[model samples]
Target chain A: MARKLASEDLTPVAGGGLLHRRLFLKAGLVLATAQTATSLRAEEVAATTPRAKPEDPADPSWIHKPGLPFTGYGTPSKYEKHVVRNIGGNRTPQGDGVSWTPLEELEGIVTPSGLHFERHHDGVPDIDPAVHRLVIHGLVQRPLEFTVANLLRYPMRSRFLFIECGGNSNAGWHEEPIQRPAGSFHGLVSCSEWTGVPLSLLLDEAGVDPKASWVIAEGADAGLLNVSLPLSKLMDDAMVGLYQNGERVRPENGYPLRLIVPGWEGITNVKWLRRLHVTDAPAMTRNETAKYTELLPSGKARMFTFVMDAKSLITSPSPGQKMHGANVYEIRGLAWSGRGKISKVEVSADGGKSWAEAELQDPVMSQCFTRFRSPWAWDGKAALLKSRATDETGYVQPERDVLIKERGREGYFHYNAIVCWAVDEDGTISHVYA
Target chain B: MSMLRCVAALMIAVSVASLAVAEEDTRVKGHIDGAHGSAAVEPAASANMRLGTPLTSDDIAKWDRTIFPDGRGLPPGRGSAKEGRVIYEQKCARCHGEHGEGGTSEELVSGPTPPSPDNPSKAIGSYWPYATTIFDFVRRSMPPAAPGSLSADETYAVTAYLLAANAIIPESAEMNAETLAAVRMPNRDGFIWIDVKK
Candidate 1:
């Protein structure tokens, strides 16, 4: 009586797919047939069973007790304590490394503020907002000094976007596949609703000099991290973000204020912003010249590569998770693009041999995380699962081999390729570069 | 009687036009009042509204510590590698190895060779594009324990020592704003702007 399910049968209708079953429940549709059947069965069971002891002390613990008092600030439930950022720092120096966002543990698009990924050069500086002042000088017609209060007075806009380190997912360039969870390997990117004043308005207030082309944005951290960004880009869509996720920005994520350049690399969105020096040329700072620059196969180093390309990753049933025997499971993952909105995400159960278009979650905004899902029926057979993303620019996420061929084997940053997870007959999953 | 009625009509029209002008003035006043009352309000003309205070030259100088590759912003100081060795032993050798071989922090000097596809060692001499970056970086952030604590002379000395140790410059060479800017790096032409092509 076993029969193979066709691809058409597996494909879900709009808003009526297996992935939207939870959404349907939230929509409040009653299951009349199941409810009536359950009621009749309950009637039969009540007639045969004895009356329960309602007044017994062991019946319930909180029956006659008052609940705990409310707290001013709330935290995640005790059961979710394990959901924390996976810290990966240098052995000698305490805070010289990076912490990854738990991407697999998160649901939907918005990554919580506390669990956002962190990348520190020296370490986080305890900056006082009152003492901190953002100075705009150099080639400007009139140099301006603004406090946090002055910045808050400007017209503000909120946007849901992702900030990804240029060095994120660099493990993919390794000779062999990394066996860690998806989050540990690729969680340097995080999404949030950032509220701030547009950089264009601030620049207009200062009146940028006609000759000024670049703006060197510097952070107030101990490292004095600085990088040069084109004034054209800052005037385009950059923001001086003051808040994150409906609250004041967290300490780890540039408390009080930060610069947010949508769809650009995270380093360009200088956290703990302190200065903006307009200039005719790039400063060619240490970060821009020495670090963050990639050496090409042609014996030339690629500099000022700011934009993060389109990428996707399948979170559930990834490495470190096991699949149950032969049932329909919802394959879920996240897709994002720096060029624009994610146009499509294709899931392939048999590696790259054939792919099916996955359903994208609602409110798929540009330069934001878009959740894509598909339902797959596993037959307890060995299979390879992979997801590839396509952005609005018609750029497809390349395969591991294709990416290696293009970028070369000496890659250290901006490693975005289709990730594959192999599912064995024993129901164990592991990373595979298919 | 007809002439009197026409005059009264003209008077009424004149009063209504004057009232309309008064109402327009009140609306403009209301806009100004709204902008003054709440900081959240968007003013009708942002060009007219002055928000931040204008910075003076001294105030700007305090935070403008950035140094360009052209040596335009280098502070006035001079030091030799010989003088730098003493300071290096006292302050830098603990974290950065005695010969800048690197212990806890990044190695300042490595083998006197450029990085290749096979053996990529991005040390100070082999990779950095500009010599002024050494002065800028050392002065801004060095001795991880206390950044921006080094004296101007100390920073220049350290820059000279690192440059000499990496075999980029002679040990006796004095480093200052002028000399450091003139010294061309080995990898000065190694970089290409990839964004320009895009």
Candidate 2:
């Protein structure tokens, strides 16, 4: 029997009282007082209990009343105050590592806008949007300059997509398992509803020269960051997003403007967008040359790999989550791809020894989030849970060892391998190689 | 019959005039750049910026050091291997290493080998399609922590050291605007024309 936090002297009942994470739809648990009442003999306690009958409903607690007014924007409930993106940096030093995103405490398809993850090379620059100017010069019939307000006047569209850091899941590449919640390992990727004007319109307005085949996109951060992208992709599905969720984007997520290349990794989508210079080829910036470029096992370095392949993760049944002894559990998670739609997702109960197809939720969108679920029965034995996504192009998610063998020990960027979580007999969960 | 024809002609003229007036009104709804017949106009604001304000031109420009595939952002800086060795240790070696071998989470130098379909390195001396990218990237996002803090002279010197270490440039060579732009990369000829069709 268990009691809630407040009702039990501000402390929850110890030892597996927390409900199984797989039970997502239930509001709360049954308390000990209610359970004891059912077990008690009715006649012995009837005189002292003085229980209110069903018809005695004249007065209800004022706390069970109507709530406050509506708001233009929304935030997470006060109960989720501890769920914040943890940022770590050296006080005297800068451009350091940051760990910790509270992935254990979230649910549903969309990540709340405020709790989206961040990784900064330099400190976040407090930019003045008024002074920000987007210059479109170099190899154009008519070079144009646009203020943020000018760009907003154009027609716009919205999409629900995810932006993932290239270095995400680097912990997976390690020899030993780095135990943490799913978010810290994969939180670098977050989904949002982005609204923006398509890149095709701006490219058309500038009148791209016939010889111009590559665009050198630059940002206005203190870094003055720049990288080259193929002109074809830039004009294809790229967007200059200004709004995330239903409101203007937060500063950490690129205030005023950012380039959103659907299905592409996050670095190519420059934030604090400032300039685009049309050119003949890639500038071959350090990021393109030395970094993001991976050396394959055959000794050939894979460069200019722009598209992010299909990937998915089971959020609820993942590691650091608890389980109640042997019952039915509903597996829930999200999947997406940059190439196109996820055609199918298969879940494994014994770590790929046996596979069962999971149910993909309705309204599956291209280059957007597709939630998946599967019903499972636990017979009180140790097992492993894993999911593999196959995209529309017939590319199946590779195993961890397969990716390592092909990419070699030198692999640093774009690690998209199947993830496995081992559930022990005692109901403890952890990352496993499987 | 003549009176009826005259009345019809008069009605046509009146309708045409009203249509012309409506078209004019819609076109000038926001601003009036030019004078049109019977259109309400907004007076133009007076200019404050005077004629003799110093022009910020590319001529005598300070920050034109953004090298592209066609070699545009390279600036005036010259350094030899002997001088570069000092600069490399003082500034770059803290992260990159003593022999340009690279540290953990850092990149190594040395490239210019042919695209190894069997084995690809993609280092400065190997798989880079253009040498100009090295100069451009170093000027922008190098040192990881302190980006865009290097001077033109430092960038050119560092690029020269990396090239020499990668065996592209000789030990005693010096690099400047003209010589740096002229340097070719190994994989420049390996690119395929992959673009989306309209």
Candidate 3:
């Protein structure tokens, strides 16, 4: 049996609508609602059940003894051990696989460095920064080689961006709805504050030749993973990421150095970056022509389709979560666009029949995750929920049918469609195509 | 009364001197270079900050293993499918299967079947656009356990074996840096680049 929630328990914000609680927006700044929700629930629990003090001359267990000494590094609490990445890999070859970030269990826009999603071709190579060198050659006036110390001296910039796998959310193309947690299906994307030096500064020093158009960025992994990127894009905003969040980048996420192509596909952001060879033509690597290319309905394969389209997913009220006989629940989700910042996200309670504007969290920068929330007053009835995003470029996320019609059914990558979660009268939530 | 007038004049002079000092302090605090006269002073041009070292041709050659579609960067080596069969049976058959049918890893050959929407088999023959990709991928990362361990001749042999098995090349075809690049893949013209306007 589900415990019923009271409508009066949730106090609406002043000057906001009755049903919607704009908890994210306060004085034009976005407040952290995950912290607020935790504190609010704690307060409600304390008010309902007050604990009596111990009667004897004995102190509480935690207070009776001194706490453990602080360490040089900290870890998540023991209670949060369940919040781990779900590893999905090949059986025979241990390294060739992916580990999905548990997006449903995470809060806020930034994905912790430890819990970030991973997609490796060969494996996570143990690279020593001392010997690692990034050589820039090919069509340049002067070919140069930079060590880890040399790259650190160049000017750098930081950005909050999302790196989504080209194959993220590909289960939507299935004939039947995938019966799994939302994160397991769509957690290939993760956001972080990456700091790095721009590739243009190095190109300027090298004196790029006039004929050079494409730059082949390669990694130092066992696979020697390489991808051809446009020189124009690299000069625009591409970075040689040295740090993730604040500290140095983790090994799995490309330690030593990485090529951070903001808003582009994840594969192009070559990890453990070792070399950049500028050329007038593309290398026509296996990944570019055979793998990442999309099989369109017109029988012509779409190659080098880099930019990730606008997509939004309601993390809560998604599959595997129950309504708990909801009275008033805050529906929260993440929206992002590779083209630019997300302008709006609309939540449809009745499955696209009607939609209401959700409040977008403040400081919504371009090519970053924008947290959105909307208050819903459930009457303990069966309902369907969905979310659609619109980017600053005026491109709206398409529905499943529309996407299938455009890309065809045989597509294996880049599936971004509106997802629907059906809430039954029994409070159980399930995936649906409605 | 004349003595008081002298003191007032002295006080006015002191006040004017302090105001001028304060103005000078403000200018200094603002980093205003008096020589430039504050008309958007440009940074002083200094010698180039040569951060990284210049690499010699030999140093560049060691790490530059990239193989372009036009046959550039292929090492000097030659092999045939006959020679590659022995190596494939011993080293690669465990993962890629006995006849390149694929067991644990990717399938290497698909025979005469073309890739379609319903039956998409991305193998060496059906999907790969360039033959140089086979040589490049095999040379760089093959036999996953011991990658980059294969000799240039061994890589060419394996590439020839895979191409021959897929019926794309003759069984006795000799594969080298130039010949491998000249081998036309079946789906070479199958791809079309579409630049979607954001």
Best model per lDDT? 3
User: Chain A TM-score for model 3, please?
Assistant: 0.88
Task: Write down the lDDT of every candidate, Cα atoms only.
Answer: 0.80, 0.68, 0.82
**Candidate 1: tens digits of C-alpha lDDT, residues A377-396:** 56668888888999999999
Per-residue accuracy of model 2 over A97-185 as CA lDDT, tens digit each: 45345555565556677877776665566878887767777777766677776666445678888787777777777898778777778
In model 1, what lDDT does residue B36 have? 32
CAPRI-wise, candidate 3 is: acceptable
- B187, model 2: CA deviation in Å? 7.3
Docking class of 2: incorrect
- lDDT at A382 for candidate 1? 85
Which one wins by TM-score: 1 or 2? 1
Using all chains and alpha carbons, the TM-scores for the candidates as numbered come to 0.84, 0.74, 0.84
How do the residues B1-198 of candidate 1 rate in per-residue lDDT, one tens digit apiece?
233234434544555676667667667877865533222322222333357679999988898988988888898999999999898998888878899888877677865565677656567877788888888777777766687999888898988998899898898999999898898887788777866432
> How does model 1 score by TM-score?
0.84
Badly placed stretches (over 4 Å) of model 1 are A1-64, B1-47, B111-113
Q: Native contacts retained per candidate? A: 0.50, 0.27, 0.53
Model 3 lDDT per residue over A289-387, tens place: 768888776556778888999999988866666666646567789999999999999888787877778888887989999998887766677888888
